[model samples]
Target: MGSLLFLAFAYLAVGQAAVNRNGAQTAADAAALAAAQDKRDQLAGKWVEEVLDPTQWQDIFDGFAPGLTPSCWRADQLASQNDAHVDGCVPGPLEFEVSVEMDNPVGDSIIPGTEGRYSTESAIAVIEPRCTFELPEEDAGDDVLPQLTCKDRNWDLDPEDLGDLPAPEDLFDVHLAD
Candidate 1:
């Protein structure tokens, strides 16, 4: 009877540790995706601003110096929402890496060292752009004829038609990498 009781307690402790680890992993994934989405929003805003300026279109099309947005703020906010805190937040070109630790430890005291220890996990997320600008080589007496191509569809750069452009969310895709 004593041996059976000890075996059951061991199984319960292992199960509790697994649950705590899964919660930490979930928080890390959410934080990373939130950060990447923030970067996508920043890129879409810059694209719109540059599209309006005909002179800036060439630079953007050539993939010149692109603007960057700090996304660690959103990562922290998201981790907190998931009952965790981000231990580290790193921003890349269009991605973010976030590590989070659970607010509370695995409370089942069946395990010795794990009673006061919290679980931690990390994840990476990326944002991909879906549009590019193209210009025709035809010289037409200095008339501006900039073109915006997106997913094999070409759209005219009419100032009035700017309203017809895709929404910022549609302009970029954000997802967790791991």
Candidate 2:
């Protein structure tokens, strides 16, 4: 009877740890995705700014403005929302790698050092741009038009098309790489 009871308790503890580890993984995934999404939004905003004034388009394309919201900030916010804390957030060119540690630990178990130890998980997300800007040729005419190519569709500076421009998600593809 004593051995059976101990075995049951041990299984329960292992199950709890598994649950905590899964939660930590979830937090890391969410944080990474959020940061990547933020970067994608920044790219879309730059596209809009260039659209407003084609003259500044080259500069914007060559060297874009800094993001209004830092990727680390977005990751931290997401981790907290998931009952975890951001252990690390590193932004690479259109990608964010995040490591999160669970705030709630698995219950004490027979395994030594299991108490008060949090599970940590890491995830990576990448953003792929769906649009490319090709500068229009210099013209003598007053009207200067730039080419906006996205998703195999050429878009001019038409007000209706501009208004119907693809959403940020459409302009960028964000997904978990690992």
Candidate 3:
């Protein structure tokens, strides 16, 4: 009976550790995705500002929008929401990498060292442009802008009337990196 009880407690401790590890991974994934989505929104907004200039569209699609702010704050916020804290957040051209640690360690585990140890995990998220456009031929009028096709949907942009613009999700896709 003593041996069986000890074994049960050991299994419980392992399960607790596994749960903490999974939670940490979830937090990291959320943080990375939030950071990438924020950057994607910024790029889409920049594109809307430079709607008439087809030359700048390519650069924006490639995640080269100038004067944009860092997106790490968004990652921190997301991590906090998941009961974790972001240890590191790195922003790439169109990707975000985030590492998160759980706020609480596995408590009172049978494993001696597990009681005070917290789980940490890292995740990466990528932003991919979903829209494509072809510049107008030479001698084309300045008022005529090229039509943008995004995810099989046609977006005919009129410089004079700028109301019906694509949302951030339509311009870029945010997903966890494989």
Candidate 4:
């Protein structure tokens, strides 16, 4: 009977550790995605600002827009929301890598040294530009812009109208890197 009880406790301890590890990974994934999404939003905004200038569209889609801000703060906020803390946030060309540690350690368990153990995990999220536009063959004037095709959806953008602009999600896709 004592042996069975010990085995049960051992299983419980392993389950506890697994849960904590999963939580850490979840937090890291959320943090990385948040950072990438933030940058995607910023780029979309920049595109709107330069809508009339088709020459700048390629640069914007490539994630090299001017006046863009760092997105790591978003990672921190997301980690906190997930009951974790971001240990590192690194921004690359079009991706963000984040490492998170669980805010709470594994609770006291039958296994020794489990109470002080915290789980840390890392994830990478990428921002991929979804829109492609070909400059008009002829000068369409400042009031008109080229049609943009994003993820099979076409956007007929008009600088003068400015009401039906593509949203941030339409311009870029944010996903966890595998």
Candidate 5:
């Protein structure tokens, strides 16, 4: 009876540990996906490929869990020693790993959400800039602080776009509309 009880307790303890490790790994994985998606979303007007770089996504990984290692699927931070991808993938389904490990985007994390039984499923993506426009910088007198001009930052007006040059009265109307 004593041996059976001891064996049962040992089994239960081992199972508990497995549960904790799995839970932590799940957390890391989910956070990685979230970070990747957010990183890509933020690069709407910048280089999509560079923004998706694993190294650049470190801060997002760190935010998932405070101390998860690269070995852990949901790392506290990145675990790219030499293998750089910003996507913290490793062996085991808990983390991102590939047979060749050439920075393949795979893996999932289970993070609980409010009023939900299923975990959040998210994937990283790159957002391309829909348009590109620039505004001329206003001349600033030599002052320590930058000047604050309330004028509109966008002044992309094509001379040809205006079929007929506006009169002085029309110019005032255009300025007032802006």
Candidate 6:
């Protein structure tokens, strides 16, 4: 009976450790995914209005750079896109880049340089996703596989991604001297 008690306590301690670790992982994944998508949305909105220059890239890191959001995961300041400028400043002028990756559905849209600013294709991929709980089907028989249901509550984009513009800029040239 004493041995059984010891075994029980050991089991409980190990289970607690495993659970704590998994919780940490979930938080980290959530934060990473959120930061990537959030950054993308911000860029998409600013793309049409202002060019993503060196300064602009710096702005991307802003206050969101460090630690995890309310959702967890680690966020850090990404360097400017110009590979030539390792110091975040380029001599031949600076440009933005797709440093962050996500499960983008709109595809890679690279904004071009027209008046010191250019466009970049947005990439959407499920960088981080929410938790999905699955249950086993009870109708499985011998040599039969049980069907599992998958629920996707993860992934997101900024409101700017859905912004309404007069028209697609690529379709025509409308220059403003602001």
lDDT, residue 39, candidate 1:
73
The estimated TM-scores of all candidates read 0.83, 0.81, 0.96, 0.93, 0.29, 0.32
Residue-level lDDT tens digits of model 1 in 97-155 = 89999999988566688878999999999776666665556564334556666675666
If the candidates were sorted by their TM-score against the true structure, best first, what order would they fall in? Answer: 3, 4, 1, 2, 6, 5
Instruction: Tell me the tens digit of each residue's lDDT in model 4 across 1-178.
Output: 9999999999999999999999999999999999999999999999988888998999999999989999999999999999999999999868999999999998899988988989999999999999898997666666667899999699987676878888999899999999
Candidate 5 residue lDDT tens string, 1-178:
9989877866665564455444444443444543333333333212222222323323322223223333332222332321222333332212232111212222222222311222222122211222222222445322212211222232233323423322222111110000
Q: In each prediction, how many residue pairs overlap at the backbone (N, C-alpha, C within less than 3 A)?
A: 0, 0, 0, 0, 9, 20
Residue 118, model 1: Cα distance from true site in angstroms? 0.9
State which candidate, 2 or 5, has the greater TM-score: 2
Tens digits of lDDT, candidate 2, 1-178: 9999989988988998999999999999999999988877887787686565666645434335555467688899999999999999998877899999998877688877789899999999888776677555666333555666677676666634567665676567899995
TM-score of 4: 0.93
**lDDT of candidate 6 vs native?**
0.28
Better of 2 and 3 by lDDT: 3
lDDT of 5: 0.30
Best by TM-score: 3
Better of 1 and 6 by TM-score: 1
Q: Best by lDDT, which number?
A: 3
Question: RMSD to the native, candidate 5?
Answer: 19.1
lDDT of each: 0.77, 0.79, 0.93, 0.92, 0.30, 0.28
Judge candidate 3 at residue 70 and give its lDDT.
97
Query: In candidate 1, where is summed lDDT lowest over 10 consecutive residues?
Result: 56-65
Give one digit per residue, the lDDT tens place, for model 6 in 1-178.
9989877866665564454444433333333334444433433344334321222323322322222222111122221211111111111111111222221122121222222322222211132111122222445322332121123222121333434322222211211111
Residue 85, candidate 5: Cα error in Å is: 21
Cα lDDT for residue 49, candidate 6: 45
lDDT of model 3 at position 174: 98
lDDT of 1: 0.77
